[model samples]
Target: MKTTSITHRLADLGGAKWDLHTAARDRSDRGEDIVEMTIGEPDVALPEPLARAATRAIEAGRTQYSNGRGENGLRDALAESYSARRGRCFERDNVLCFPGTQTALYAVMQGVAETGDEVLVGDPLYATYEGVIRATGADMVPVPLKAEHGFRMQADDIAQRITERTRAILLNTPHNPTGAILRPAELEAIAEIALKHDLWLISDEVYEDLVFEGNSFTSPLTLEQIADRTIAVSSISKSHAAPGMRSGWAIGPRGFMDALLPVSETMLFGNQPFIADVTEEAVRAGSTVADGMRQRFAKRAQYLADRLEAETVLRVHRPEAGMFALVDVSPLGMDCDAFAWALLENAGVAVMPGSSFGAHLQNWVRLALTVEDAAMTKAVDRISEFARSVAVAAQ
Candidate 1:
C-alpha cells in the first residue's frame, strides 16, 4: 500500500499557514504580552438584544438543526433586513442561510467553480479567497488593485484579464487589508463586464454596514441586470460584532438558492437554529444593530489613522471607511513578510502582510483596528517606534 498525501490544489496556498495560534503560544511561553493587529477580530460586545435573544432561544430549547434555507421566519427577516439596511431587495426564496460567511463563500465557489476554471480576484484581496478558489481546484487570476487607486480594482484592468476560462469574479466591498470601497461608476462598469462575460459575480459584503466618510457600500445584488448573476455573501460577524455566533446568509436569484442548498446541505446539515434565531432577532431590530456597530468602528478607524500619520516610514492610506488601515512600508526597504515578522518578534506587534492578500503587493501591510482601544494604541506605538528607527537609519 502507498501512503497518500494531501491534494495538489491545496499545495500552493501560502497564507493558510497563518500561525497566529503558534505565535500566541510562543508569546505565552516567553511570558511576553503581544499586541495583535493582524486578525480582524471585533473587540466590541455583541448587541445586548442579540445576546438576550440567544439566551432566550437556548432557554426555549431552540438548539436543534433548522431548515437548510433557514427557518421561514428568519429567512423573511433577512430579506427585510437587507432591503432596509443595504438597499437591496430579495424575496425569502433568494436567501440561503449558513453557519458563517466563510461557509457561504466556500459554497458559492464549490457550486460555480469547476476544476481548472479561473476566478478573477483583486490582488491584495482578502487572503481566504485564494484558498477557497484553490480548494475548488480553480485557478486564481489576481487583478492587482493599485495603491495609487486607493487599492480599488480598476474595471479596465479586470476586463483585460477576463478569459473564456473565467467562471466568476470575487469582490469584497469595504475591502479587507485595504478599506477601499468601489465607487459607483466603477461598480456600474464591473456590472457591464459581468453582463458581457456572462460570469457569476460573487461579492463578499460582510462589511456592508462599516462604511464611513460618506462612502456607502454598493452591493452587486442591487443591480437589476446583474442581480441574477450576483451571489451576495454577508454575515453578522462584522456588522453585529458577532463572529462567535457564526451566522450568515447568501442571497441571489431563486436558481442560486436551489443550487446552493444542495451544496450547503451535503456539507453542513443546516444553519444552527439557536444562532439563526438570535440573528433574526438582531436583523428585525433593524439599523440599531448594524449602524451602531459602524459608528463604533469609525471611531476606532480614526484612532488608528491618527497614529499611522505620526509615523515617518509608513505611508498610510487613511481608509475612507472600514475597520482596517493599509500602510505602504516600501519606504522601510523591507518586504511585507519580513516587516510583519520583525514587527511581531522585535516590536511585539503583529499585523498581516499585504503579500498575503496577493502577489503584486509585497511592501504593504494591513492593521485591523478591530482590536480593543488600549491594545490597538500600544500596537500603534510599537509600529511608530519601528518606523522611526527605520527613518533615522535611512537618514
Candidate 2:
C-alpha cells in the first residue's frame, strides 16, 4: 500500500512529550532514583468520590457514547460552577465536553484559525500550545514574558504583535512553567486588546483553583462583553488530581462553540459517556475536593520556595499562585537543558528546561512543586549541592 504523505505541519509538532521520557531513560541508565519535577503530574491520590462516581457510572452501563456537545448534566454542573466563580451565566448550549483540555484547546484553535493565520502566544507558555497551533498550520507568534515581570504578559506587548493575520490570543492563568497569574488589571488590559483587535481569547484556566498565597484567579468570562469572544477551557485533571478521568469542557459563546463542534465531531465523534457521567459527580462535589488539593499543593510550593531561598546559584521567581517556580540559574551560567541533564546525572533530580517553554529563556529551569513535600525537600537539597559543585568547578 502506498503511504499517505504527511503534512509539513505535523513535522513541526514532534518531541513535545520527550522531556519526561528523556528524564525517565536517563535515570534508568544511571541506576539512580530520580525525583521527577519535570511534568505537572500531581503526585496526589485521586479524590475518593471520583472513584465511587466512576464505579457507579460503569455499573449503570454508561460506557456508551454521549452527545457531541456533552451530557446536559455535566454541562449544567460546569455552567453552575462558572456562574458561582465568575458570576457569568452559562447555559448547557455554551459548553462542549472533550476527553481533556488538550483536545478542547486543539478543537478551539482549529475552529477559529485557518492555515497561515497567526496566534499571539505568551512566551514561557504551557509548551503544548505551540504544537496545537502548529498542527493547525497557524503561525505561533510568541510574545516573551520576562522573569523580571513575574513572567506576566503585558497588554501593550500583545498589542504590538497584533496584525491582520492574528486570529486569537491564548491566555493561561496560574500559567504552567511559571505559575504567572494574570491579575484583574492585567487581564483587563489584554481583554481591551482582544476587544480592540477583534481577537478571540482562548483562556486556559486548568490551574485556576491551585492558586497559592491568597492570589485571586480572574477569568475573562467575568466580563460580559468578552464572554461572547472568549473560550474558557478547564479540566478535572489538575483540580481534583483526576488526570486518569480525562474529562474537560470548553465554556464560551454558543456561536464560537458551534464552530468547534464540527472539529469535535470529526476528531472524537463524541466524548466518553462513562467519563461524562463521572464528570457530573466531580463538578457537583468538586468544591471541597478541589480546595483540599489546592491546600496540599500550596504547602508543597511553600516548602520548595523556602528551600530555593537558601540557594545562592539559582533564583526562584516566587509566584503568588500555582504549582511551579520559574527558577533562573544564570548565576551558574549554564544552559537550562545542560543544567537539567547534569542535575539528572549527578543529583538524580529531573526538571524541565525553560527552553521547553520558549526560546528566549535558555538559562532558566522550571521545577514542579506539586510532588510530596518530603520528595520536594530532598530534590531541593540535591539541586543546592549540585549548584555548589558547579560553582567550585568554575573557580
Candidate 3:
C-alpha cells in the first residue's frame, strides 16, 4: 500500500509559496480592512462579445467533449494567428488545445523532459513553473535573472548553465513576477544555444498581448533553424480577461504535437466545446482587453515606481510589459518576507514576498498593478510611511 514517488516530488510545490497571501486572507476574514495586492488576478472583466459567444455556444448545445487535439476550427484559428505573427506557416496539426497554459506547459514538460533530466528556466519565475517541471520527474535548473538587466533572463546566463542533462529551456516572456520581455536578438541567441545543444525550447507566452508601446515580444518559434525544437503555450486568460474559460493551446513541431496527443488524451481527452467555440471566436476577433490592461498596468506601475522613489527607500524595477510590479525592499533593513508581513499587519496592504518566486528575489516584493489609482495611491502612501519609519529607526 503505497503512493507514487511523483506524489512526493510535487508535494512540496503548492501550499507554502502562498503563506503570506494566505495569512493576509485569514486576517481579512476576521473583519480586517485589507487591500490585497499579492495575487495577479486580472481586475478587468471579460468582454461582451466573448461572453455572448460562450452563451450562444451553450444554447447551440455545444457542450460535448472536443477531439483529442481540440475542435478543428479552434486549432485552425490558433495556427492562423501564430502564422501571421511569426512569419512561419502553421497548421492545425501543430496546435494542441488544453484547458489553460498550466496544463499545456505540464504536457509539454512531460513530452520534452523526464526523470534525471533538467529544464532551464529563469529564476524568480511564476511560482508554478517548478511544480510542473517536477511533476514530469525532471529538475528545473535556475538561471538567475539579475536586477541590473531589468530581471530579463540573459542569453549568456542560460548558455552557461546548460549541461548534458539539460533537455529543454523554458522561457516566459513577457515574464511573470518581473514583467521582463526578452528582445528579438536575445531570443535569437537563445535559439543558437538550443541549436548547438540540441535542446527543446519551451516558451510560456501567456503575457504576449500585454506589451506596452515601447516594447515588443518575440517567440523562439520565429527562428527558422530551431523550428522543430520550439514549443509555445498561451491562454486567453490574460489577453481576453477570460481566466474562467480555462482555454489554451500548445504550438510546436508536428512531431512533438503528434507525440503529445496521446498524453493530452489520457489526461483530459477534450476541452468543453462551448468554451473552445468562445476561444476560437476570441482568437479570430483578436484580444480586445489587452490594450486597456497594458495602458492601466503601465500607468499604475510608473506611478508606484515614482512614488516609491520620491517618498521612500524602496525602489521599483520598472517593467517592459505584463501586470506585476517588482519592488526592491532591501533598503527597509529587512528581507521581503519580513517587510511584507509587517506592511500587511501595520498598513492593511498585502503583497507577495520575493521568496515566493525564487531565492534571487528574496530582497524584493511583488504587487499587482491591476488596482485602481486611488487604491494604488493609498497602498503606496502606507508603504511610504511604513518605509520612512523603518529608515528612521535604522538610522
Candidate 4:
C-alpha cells in the first residue's frame, strides 16, 4: 500500500528547536539533570482572577459554541482595550479572537495574501512565520535585520524588496529571538512604505507588554493613515502566562475584519468559551499583571546577559524588550547548530540555535529568559564551560 505524500510546503517546516526540546525532555525523563533554555515560555502562572473567571464560565455552562467572530463581550472588551492603546475608535467589528495568536496570524495572512504573492518578513523572526506564509501558498521575502542596526528592521530595506506581487509586510515588535523593539520612527517609516506600496501590515505585537525600561511598544494602528491596512495581533499567552488557555486576537479595520470572519469561522468555528471568558477578564483587568511580569523579566534578562558576558566568549546582545538574548557564538569556532547540540549533549543544557531563526543567524544562539534564576544561573555556568572548551579545542 502506498501512503499519501505530505505537501512540500510543510515538509521542511519545523525547526531544530523542537527536536532539541524533545531531547531535553527525554534526558529529563531518563533522570538526567537538564537545564532547558530553548523554548520562549514564561515560567509564570495565570493570574488568580483570570483563572477564576475561566472556572466560573466553565461551571456556568459557558462551554457552548460562541459567535464565530468571538464571544460578544470578549470582543467588545478587546476592542475597548485596543482603542485605548491605539487612540482610535475600535468596535467589536474591528476585532476577531481565536484559540491562539498563531491562528489569528494565519487568518490575517490568508485574508490579505493569495497564492504566488510575496510577503516581506524580517530575518531572524519567530520561526513559525516562514512556515505560515509558505503554507498560505505565498512566498516569504526575507528583509535582513543587521546586528549593526541593533537588529531593527529598516524601512529602506523593506522598500528595496517590494514588488508588484508583494501583498503584505509582517512586523514583530519586541521581536522574538533578538528582542529588538521597533521605535516609533521605524514604525512610521515602515507604515509609510506599506501605505505607499498599498500593502497590508501584519503587526505581531505579542511581546508588546514584555518591554523593558527605556524601551517601549508601538503599534502601526496608531498611525492614522495606515490604520485601515494594519492588522495588529496579540495575546495574553505571554503577558498573562496563560499559553495553555490559547486566547488571542487580531484587531484591524472593520472591512478587513469582516473579510477575516469567514476564514476564522472555517478554521476555528469559534474560540473556547471558557478561554474567551478568561481573556475578557484578563483584558479588562488592564496591564497591571503584565507590567509586573515585565519588571521580573527585565531583571532576569539582565541577570542572564551579565552571566553570559562575564563567563562566555559569546557576544551577547542584551534584549531591550522581549525575554530572549541573541548571542553570537562565532568566537567558539562552531556554527550555532553544532554548538547548541554539542552543549545540550555534553553539558545537559538546551538553547535554540540561531540557524533555527534564519540563515543570517547561523553563528548565533538564542537564550530564553523564561528559566528561573537558579536554573538560569546553572545553565549559564554550563554554557560558559562549553564555550571555553570549544575555544581551547579551536586553539
Q: Pick the candidate with the highest TM-score.
A: 3
Per-model lDDT: 0.81, 0.82, 0.92, 0.86
Off by over 4 Å in 4: 1-6, 15-17
Q: What are the clashing pairs of model 3?
A: none
Write candidate 1's Cα lDDT for 60-154 as tens digits: 98988786788887899988876775576667998998888998898889988987699999988887788788878788999989978888888
**lDDT-sorted candidate list, best first:** 3, 4, 2, 1
Better of 1 and 4 by TM-score: 4
Runs in model 1 with CA error above 4 Å? 1-6, 12-16, 85-89, 287-293
TM-score of model 1 vs. true structure: 0.92
lDDT of 1 at 121: 92
Q: Write down the lDDT that model 4 would get.
A: 0.86
**Each model's backbone clash number:** 0, 0, 0, 0
TM-score sort, best first: 3, 4, 2, 1
TM-score of each: 0.92, 0.95, 0.98, 0.96
Provide the lowest-lDDT 10-residue window in model 4.
1-10
For residues 152-200, could you state the per-residue lDDT of candidate 2 as single tens digits?
A: 8999889888889999999998788787888789988898999998899
| Model 2 worst lDDT window (10 residues) | 3-12
Per-residue lDDT of candidate 3, residues 299-393 (tens digit): 99999999899999899999889889999998777999999999998899999999999879989999999888788988989999999998998
Candidate 4 displacement at residue 38 in angstroms:
0.7
| Winning model by lDDT | 3
Q: For residues 161-181, could you state the per-residue lDDT of candidate 4 as single tens digits?
A: 999999999999879889898
**What clash pairs does model 1 have?**
none
The TM-score that candidate 4 achieves is: 0.96
